[model samples]
Target: MKPSKNIVLIDSSRPIDRDHLLPLGRLRDLPEQIKRAHTVVVTKCPPEMDIADMFLWEQRLKMPAGIEVQFTTLKYADPLPVFPQEADKRYIYSKFAILLTSIANPRHLRYHLLSFYKISSDLEFRDHHNFSNRDAGKIKRWALKHNKALIITTEKDAQRLSALTQLPDEVKSRMFYLPVEAVLLRSR
Candidate 1:
């Protein structure tokens, strides 16, 4: 398929440390991709990951003219505690579905999580360790419901969650791994 002129690519994977950014493999030819991008957004965890450094790298590479690079951090406010109970199951199920299936904004997964999960303005669920089997079950049910169209998730999360055998067949069938690739482009 031809690349969309208005398409926006997002990179939220970890390993952004200075050490990881070196070795040329990570930095090589990135400016070319930036040139092709109309707008590039990097998603990161606030306080933990510094985006300024990434911007500096982009500047050093002399990014393509007119391409805009932006960054947004995902923040956790409060936990949306879920207990394994009959009455709360449906709500919890919906919350899990929203968390796993939706990717409305490439820059802020937290925003999508909050709005889609019906998370109270005061509540936030950031860490993956907070998820329970009950939550996974909900996500499984959602994947089944939606026919699981190649469920797209960050490589880091996929590495962690793909080991769960409890995931339904539908969920597994539709799972698609996203491999990060830098698209190099020549100056116009």
Candidate 2:
């Protein structure tokens, strides 16, 4: 398919952290990009993401007067598992072990949800589960077994997956990656 001249792709995965607002980076350039595009496609936003403030910020930053922000749901490729316990160390330990050791684990789901929602820092073990491609492969297997859709992961994963020589056809067929871009929109 031909790339759309009218669309600009934005990575909603990156949190609105302080460093992002520093000086030079995608965050600083967002307002200008929004002003230029007639439509904006936000990839990786959680299902319930609210764009009210994002739009207001665009307007506040002097984005084009009538530009519109459109959201798209990019399926999370490796959705973390929705486990059923918080205090059961044995359960938590088992779940964590599955996430770390099993090829079909879904523990990342918790982390993703937590991060996406900007959950309180008071939450414990925030830095745990350091994800890697090995874990991602396990996720792919899990998705296949569950007949689930492939996830939309970072470009890094897309690159790695593409280069994988032993990936199964089932997993390969489910791979649908959304690339990020910023472009000018023609007057419409």
Candidate 3:
């Protein structure tokens, strides 16, 4: 099937291996099959990323010659408290934070966290994990234990939390989410 335009976006941080994660890592189409793409985007690029990074990926992805590769970076915005009424203090990342993440690749968030905050603790969950009562209990314990630590999560997780009723008010009050935007870095 032919499409009007073909743009392939591959995560820049994906480990270069077909069997990296079994079924999840398996590619639907081979590099040769995607040679017709008009644009190949390297998503989740770091601010310090260079054009040279594309050269390494070229050897790994084995793309067709002259396929334009564009780099994209995630720009983070200020942390927004989940419960405005209860969370009176604004998040100041320079203080302390405990990262709670349930995403495929959290390195982008981790990068921003490291730059802006002193990480007190980090809790990683399966991608798209739904928080339960027990999960909330654990989070509350951590937050209360680390009196000064601000609980942090991604905007996606924050969205998911909004639908969950099991998490305690205490945990919700302290939790905050950082919003991020993907910006394309035009090639020179």
Candidate 4:
């Protein structure tokens, strides 16, 4: 199936991965893909991002003149419990957090959380990681060690973490996920 036009999406949250800015695995084809793109959407950007910097990105990416470039930022909602039944609501207000992430880039979420809480520890996993029982055990142990700190994970990882039947009551009580949605920033 051939699309009428291609829209290339670039994540503005992280540093450029060498020449190709996208987090795709096939690095060689990305530049060509961007060249064919009718519009380029920069995702996960901060709302207050400088307009001049956006133009700089265009030059850095070598985007062809007249190609439309748009910017977007991920807006995060209030923390939601992974296991509502076991969740202790007070943990949501904790001053410290332990971050667990299985996404390609967690820097944006980390930056957001730093505004409200002191991140004590960070646990990172490969993108789309399947949570194993051992992984659950590790998290459970970590929660046990830091009983007062809120255990936070991205909305995507929360799905996999909640599916683990072996997670203890303690872990479930302290764990929460922040839901995120992308909002486009209009060029001034």
Tens-digit lDDT string for candidate 4 (13-97):
4434455533544254645557787888878877787878887777777777778888888899999999999999899899999
Indicate the residue-level lDDT of 6 in model 1.
Answer: 49
Model 3, total clashes: 0
Worst 10 residues of 4 by lDDT: 13-22
* Of candidates 3 and 1, the better by lDDT: 3
Model 1 per-residue lDDT at 183: 29
What is candidate 2's CA lDDT for residue 114?
A: 44
lDDT of 4 at 178: 99
RMSD of each: 12.6, 12.1, 2.8, 2.6
> Pick by TM-score: which candidate is best?
4
Q: Count of backbone clashes for each model?
A: 1, 7, 0, 0
Rank order (by TM-score, best first): 4, 3, 2, 1
Q: Model 2, 20: alpha-carbon shift in Å?
A: 7.3
lDDT of 2 by residue, 1-188 (tens): 96566666555554333225535554654344555666655544445545664554344435466666555443444232222121122221121121112112223343553443332111111233344566457655665554433333333334544555454555454443334333322121
In lDDT terms, how accurate is model 1?
0.44
TM-score of 3: 0.82
Ranking by lDDT: 4, 3, 1, 2
- Residue 49, candidate 3: Cα error in Å is 2.1
